[model samples]
Target: MMSTLAERIQKQDQRALAKAITMVDNDHPDKLSLLSEISGQEKKAHFIGLTGSPGAGKSSLVDRLITHIRNMDKTVAVIAVDPTSPFSGGALLGDRFRMHKHFADPGVFIRSMATRGSLGGLSRSTKDAIRVCDAFGFDYILIETVGVGQSELDIMKVADTTALVLTPNSGDVLQIFKAGIMEIADVFVINKADLPGVQKLKTQLKEFLHIADPKSWQPPIVETISTEHKGIEAFFEACEAHKKFLNETDAGKQKRKEQLTYEVYELMREELWKDVERFIGDDPSKEIALQKENDPYQLAKEWLSEWREKGGGS
Candidate 1:
């Protein structure tokens, strides 16, 4: 069944792709099996991450980028992480309204995922969503994150190109830099270039980059008025250049390899946590102990010792 779904994805069936992604988002029992079956069908889709503070016009920028990408006759998929709806516990599905024109186009796919209390401002399944998009043969996949300040570094683990969006006079740049986002940015986009202080922001970025002096890829800062669709071309050119660099330098491959290694450990950690939870939940004694214990360190030691004694250890 998973293979059939993967074959449908390889054929670019949108319904099949959406179903698979739903599996990922819901943490379905067959999610991993489906992902494994579809792994090899992945094409060379450029994964671009857009992150910034709220009111920095990230949605507008993404809207414009979708138009630009479609103008170039390429297929693109957008996975926008949105704040969870309090009632439904699902993505609020707001950004789609701004980019509504593209919904009619067959080559464009936009999905909103609820952050669901993830401190990093992204859905836990976003990387898997990107992989699912890759299998569907899109030319590009754009991930627009919710604007959680420091934890936005989660994008670094998933994106091939991390574009940090900022507004000229909004002080978004300072907050981003202070949060160490500068270290992960493959490109810097100043979205409201029509506003004052564009040059000042540029100067600050230059000074910071100069101090950092990265030996590999030096991130380029592009100014744009996303509302007017200006500088989208330049922004894309910078992305294209970085994509080429990744292809030529083997950096992209290494990044994915490292991500895969980390995913392995992450998966193991998640499984272990589930097992421990089940172990504790099934036993009234453990629950009573948990309620009574004040020393977390000793309680953890006792839990581990008991778990190992009960055939949990190798």
Candidate 2:
């Protein structure tokens, strides 16, 4: 069944792709096997991540980028990570509405994902979703993160190239610098450049960069008015250049290695936590004990010890 689904996905069937993504998001028990089958071979789609504060016009820029990329005669997949809805636990952003013109374009696939309690602005299954899109044969994969400030650095772990979107008049530069965002960003995009404070924002960014004194591959800053579709080409050019640097230098290879290492540890941690949860949840005695005990640390230690003794992780 999984093999057939993988085959359909390889054939570029959108239904199959959507099904695979649903399986991943729901954390289906067979998801690891399905992902492993599909990832047996590597795909070359460039993964670009755009992240920043809310109201930074990330979705607008992404819509423009979609048009730009499509004009190049290439296919693209978009994963817009949105904050979970307070009541439904589903993605709150209706990204498709903004880019609805592409609804008839078979070459463009867009999916909105909820962060689902992850502190970082990405879902736990996001990387897996990316691989699923790669398997479906896209020329590029754009990951638009939930615009939560500072903690969106997890994009570095998943994206081949990361573009940080900043807007003018927001006094965001200093906060970005303090949050160490300037250090990880490969490309800086000053979106909403037509605003009054554009120059000041650029000046502040330059001063900060000079103070930062980056070791290698200085990040490029591109001004963009996404609403007007201005600077879209330059924004992509900067991202393409960063992709080139990653390809030519040892930096890209090192990043892939680090991502793989992170994935291994993350997957293990997730699976282990699930096992422990199931163990405790299924036991009435454990539930009663939890009600009786007020000391969480001691209860946690006892549970781990008991789980291990019962061949839970052994």
Candidate 3:
């Protein structure tokens, strides 16, 4: 059944992709094994991350970019990470509404994910979904995160290029910069270009970019009216240029190596937590109380000593 499902996913079956994503989201025991089996089949897809403050038209910009990419005969996969509702523990999934026109296009695949309390601005299931898309041979994979705050900056680690979308007169540009967005942006986009203060925003961004002293590559600012599908081509061109620049520079390769190293560490941490949970069973209160009562360092030492004595650490 797993192999059949994997085959279906590799064929780009939407239903299969959805099921695979659910398996990962639920953290099924078989998920890791399945991902491992399919790991070798995955291809490298061009990853683009779009982030900004809420109401910056990120969804619309993504919609336009998808349409543009489709017109160029590229198969695109989109992972739209929505803010989870605290009361319901469910995503509103509102980003899909913006890209409704592409619902019937086979060349495009869209999945909405809830951040689900992930501090990094992406859902745990998102990486798996992207892998599935890559295995299915998508030409481009675009990730759109809920425009929250600093956490959205995490997208830089996963995306090949990160585009920070903003709007004219939003008055949040400075705040975003202050929030540490400058370091993650490969391209800065001022959406809703027809609005007043567009040039002022552009000038401000240029000045700020200079002051930020981004490593080697200076981030380019692009203007677009996403709702009208204007300037989208230029935005894509900028992305391509960034990709070229990355391929030509040592910095890009070093960044990729570091990203892989982090991923390995993340995977190891998850595995260790899973094993600990399995050993502790459903009730971890005892362990929690022990750690709270004793110093954390001492508690860790005690646990390690116990595990070692029991031959479990090996």
Candidate 4:
């Protein structure tokens, strides 16, 4: 059954791709095997990240960008990460509603994902979902995060080009310096350019960029009125330019290496946590209930000593 699905995925069957993504998202038992089978088969899609403060209209911009990319005869895939509901472990998944117009187009694939309590504006399966889309032969994969924050920046690490979108008079321009966003952003978009204070925001961003001194490639600032589909072309062109710069310089190589290392560390941490849980028992509430007065550091030290004595790690 897995072999047949792998073959169908290789053939670019949408149904097969959807099934594979579902398995990855749900953390199915066969996920590792499926991902291994499809590893190294990506068609080299341009992975882009769109992130901003809520009400910055990132979804609308992505919708427009999809249309622009499709008009150029390129296939596209979108993974919209929405905030999860703490009470229900579910998400509104409202991005689908904004992008439903493309539903009839086979060339455009859209998936709405919940953050699932992950602080990084991405689920544990998001990187796997990216691979699924890339291996499915899409020309582009756009990852839209929930909002601009530390979690969003962490999530942007996977994107080859990340565009930080803002709007006029939203005070997001001030946020550029805080939260380490200035360092991570590859491009900036001032959405709702028609509104008041657009020029002031642009000036502030330019001044900040000038002071930041991005040596090899200065991030471009594009003013976009996404509702009118204006500036979409320039925004894409900036992305292309950034992609070219990355390819031509050592920055791109270094970034790829860093991303690989991060992935390895993340996976290792996940596995180690699981092993520790199994050894100590799964219910933390019980542990706390029994040892309410114990010092957490001392208990952790003892646990580590026992794990080492048992030859739990290499």
The numbered model that scores best in lDDT is: 2
Better of 2 and 3 by lDDT: 2
Which ten contiguous residues of candidate 3 have the minimum total lDDT?
274-283
lDDT of 1 by residue, 170-227 (tens): 7755666777777888999998899999989999889889989666899999988987
Q: Per-model C-alpha lDDT, please?
A: 0.84, 0.87, 0.80, 0.84
lDDT of 3 by residue, 267-290 (tens): 888777766656556447656767
Candidate 4 backbone collisions, by pair: none
Q: TM-score of model 4 relative to the true fold?
A: 0.93
Summing lDDT over every window of 10 consecutive residues in candidate 1, give the lowest-scoring window.
115-124
lDDT of 4 at 11: 89
Worst 10 residues of 4 by lDDT: 282-291
TM per prediction: 0.93, 0.94, 0.88, 0.93
Model 3 segments more than 4 A misplaced: 1-3, 278-314
Candidate 1's TM-score reads 0.93
Pairs in steric clash, model 1: none
How well does candidate 3 score on lDDT at residue 30?
84
RMSD value for candidate 3 = 2.9
Model 2 collision count: 0
